[model samples]
Target: MTKTVQSRALSLAPGASRREMLNLTGAAALASAIKLAFPSGAMAQGTGPEVKGTRLGYIALTDSAPLIIAKEKGFYAKHGVPDMEIAKQASWGATRDNMALGAKANGIDGGHILRPKTHLYTTGKVMQNSQPLPMYTLLNLNEDGQAISVSNEYRDLNVQKDSSPLKQAFERKKAAGKELTAAMTFPGGTHDLWIRYWLAAGGIDPDTDIKVIVVPPPQMVANMKVGTMDCFCVGEPWNEQLVNQNIGYSALTTGELWFRHPEKILGMRADWVDANPKATQAILMAVMEAQMWCEKMENRQELSEIVGRRQWFNVPVADLNKRLQGDINYGNGREVKGTNLYMKFWGEGGATSYPWKSLDTWFVTENIRWGKFDPKIDIKALVDKTNRADLWREAAKTLGVPGAPTADSRGVETFFDGTKFDPAAPLDYLKALKIKRVA
Candidate 1:
């Protein structure tokens, strides 16, 4: 079978795409037959995964390293999903549209996505014509490492951690008849919520004091360079790139807003996971191993180089390396070295990678605070349906991951602004927020 498979693969056209090769060889589909022959999460001796591959999407952010590293380091191939395609998405909105299309329609099965997106897509809040695209939160890709950056126009104001200085600066800009804009990657994404929380904590009403807009992660620095936005929140290495280019200064990493806050997640279509359970587990195991690789301090430089290659992020290694290693130059005269605010891929005992249901509850509640979800929406039901922490645990067990959490909830979370969000009482958390759009 190996010889035949290799011969058939070598027989493909010279310039055949990965998708075309998979189709012609029936490698992905044939692996599904293997699934029936074996059992879910149980591979037959010397056999490949349920499917050879599936398309996944990602933006050029550094948090997407796990998926990229998984493909780059042969982790995916090792797990029998050798044909995994990690495609670059143009923007978060594009990611959403492609996700709604699904892999069967030339779209991605899943990839690095915002935590709130699963809830948004599942409920059809951000889908086309309110058509729900059921998705599952398989893994928390990384924690913290996202930052809010200010345009160089406000350099003298010296904003860092606290966003209050921006409140007056923005008010002055607005009173002068100039539009004050704050940009985030997506409407209900981590960036949007982070910037909103930062602004609101500093007494600036995001809805009233500033005009919020959607800017793709890569376009953020360019927009700020052109004076299109006052500040923007997004994941590294864009924030690092903006500082390197002298276009903006970092106010604070999202970790400062809420220490070790969850960011991007590995999300997939529920239908795809249901149809290819073993393949799903294969992909998860591969990504989990990659996350462990990314977490090692010694591999930080090498990790940055691989992701910064032209085929991947096309960014300079200098822009990614420093921040990835916890050395941050805020570009506002406030620099910190060896800080604990770096991006975390796998915390103590795999804490960073585990998909915590409580984190999902916080994201959903924040969306509700901003009026993205109806106040009457059942937050618990939404979290239970969208967050697939059970699958994460199963994959971890198979991988022999040590110290995976046994409980679904991580308990109460406290942010930098002295506000606490108890996952058990999401409504009370919402009630404590003073700048909410909800009644």
Candidate 2:
């Protein structure tokens, strides 16, 4: 028992009844027994993390900052996962392949991954050999800050928040028998969904009117410079770098499409998480702590510099700085100072970190919209198997964090086109979409 409980047990009133004394003593005994059984709060001493560390992979996106910062600032070490490796992944495809291989085969246990990856991996939609790799969605890494950039070829068209102007322009190009392509990191990933949503909202069919292709986040700017793609949606600092290089202008930040939307997540192989629960907790706690650090305005500069180091992103601090601090230069003569569209790592009292099943439902629904998953698939069941919000709550409680989400869902989410996604009725949302591949 703690000192306070012990003191309460000792301080029995002079006229205290025998029953009162017995009750206090009994309560103290139970507390002591419980403490003894589960020492150090959750796990007994020496029964801490089952493993010292695990391999974690990350792309060079700014959203991967939490994982990078966790390793850099010793949060992983502070949480007893000192040997964690934050390896850089070549592309999202590489991430998927390595994830399927697992750490024992020189893959990652998990790090920063796209949120949809959890559903995709669990369902085996994107896995090699069509084999399902059960996974866990631990925590959301960050939100907002991803952008869609249009090539300078369309800069004269002045494509901004509304992409309707591109419809005619793309049609004209296609009429000339020229191939127009839109690039995203993965087929069923966030970038894919964002670009598709933007195009469809403006009356452009993503699959038919324009060719969609997969390009890694880091390669986005380079590919665009060589005229490999007409437009691309990706997380920074590539978009910011594209602006710097004068090759393209950002049509809009993804936040403009859906403010503070769910982006990347902390995902892991389920078998590894199940096998090492304590280690998993340590990793989560560490990343959570790092996320809090990254959210601080004062630390953003250091965050950019640290992640920009040659060993991490190999990017200059300039490409990452402006956006990380909420400064936007659309590169089409539009600039915003200190906007709220900045990437959020941890929102008011850690709300952003809490993994909402509603968001997962939308991802699953969107994937279904694009026919990545079958319409008859059980989204809720798949979400239940993959989402580990219960684990997030446990860590929050252990860390004495207040204001954790009380429910699983974040309620109905409305997008830029005024369409609403009611988590309770996902099919209704899907049916409302006019440009979806789903029948």
Candidate 3:
């Protein structure tokens, strides 16, 4: 059998590189033989991964579920990553800082992060050190779980989906010589973009009309209770906590803003991926399997129980289960039963996990629209550099999942406000926005 296998391998590759030769051979059997022979000296000459320990970072949001589940449920270990370390980051800023530190210095190798921040770091717009950190988004973590929660003061004003009432209140506050403040998790991040778009859609300028503040996700509820912010946008449990505490009400979910909108992503430093491609693929496969588990409706209650532990989110299991089960209470006596727009881990048609480059392009355009980055920068090049759809496709193919219909674009996406974003012409879409900071 050994001689026959050798002959087959040689016939397939008369003259090939060591890696290619191993690929032509039966890689699984050859890998086992190489490990037995070498012990710890060398790896099999194959396309198989170099198994190594990885330190992953995650913030305390419900969308961080995939990474958390991957670690807690032994998916990482089952996929050849037995020494994976899951670190809970204090905030998104801290996650980025740890990722910048890299894995060698006890920092994170990768993280669940904001999609736009990947572009920001790649363009050197975020961390302005002499050396910029280039990052790649391997996959989107989850979609449409975030929401805009306003203070109880707006309840009587009839502020639900439409922010026009909130805008009027802002104007009234300004006329009274007071400031109306709105908060997001990070500047130029996903929450920031959502709140800005929501405000701007109602004819309220996010920059000049109101003050925007930055608060961490875990701190959002406490800050809102103390009247530090009028309205804030963030992920689950925190928003529901506000409603539970009777301090605020959810005006609109992000899903209501843009259905299945891309949110947190699985991000890694570009250099790490370049040096450890196989390890990166291994990590993605584990996370993707965990994502498939998270998408199961029957598993959500158990998921909430697991993620709600003190070691993880530290929130009540009930709060996490509320949104996880798709039961939304607006905290204004309006309840939506069995809604389809809850947080989606892996949506039908591979929508949630696939890192669409066009989505990254849209984020870059929004960043340019908000003056976070220069409009003259090459949007396509930036998207190509940061969004690692190719890597995701490879991982999916290895896992036997269906590939995305297209590599770069997800076609035209329409928002709730009847705004259509054409990925092919991002600048034109930006030009059409009536209430934007850019000219």
Who wins the lDDT comparison?
2
- Candidate 3 stretches with Cα past 4 Å from truth are 1-48, 128-130
Mind giving the per-residue lDDT tens digits that candidate 3 earns over 399-433?
88864444578899999789999999998999999
- Cα displacement (angstroms), candidate 1, residue 410, comes to 0.9
Ranking by lDDT: 2, 1, 3
Weakest lDDT window of 10 consecutive positions for candidate 3? 8-17
**Each candidate: what lDDT?**
0.90, 0.91, 0.85
TM-score of each: 0.90, 0.90, 0.90
lDDT of 3 at 95: 80
lDDT digits (tens) for residues 1-439 of candidate 2: 6675556545644454666555644665645544544445444446789888989999999999999999999999998889999999999999999998889999898878999999999888899998999999999999998999999999889898789999999989989999999999998999999999999999999999999999889888999999989999999999999999999999999999999899999999999999999999999999999999999999999999999999999999999999999999999888898999999999976889999999999999999999899999999999999999999988888887878785999898989889899999999999898999888
Instruction: Determine the C-alpha RMSD for candidate 1 after optimal superposition of all C-alphas.
Output: 7.8
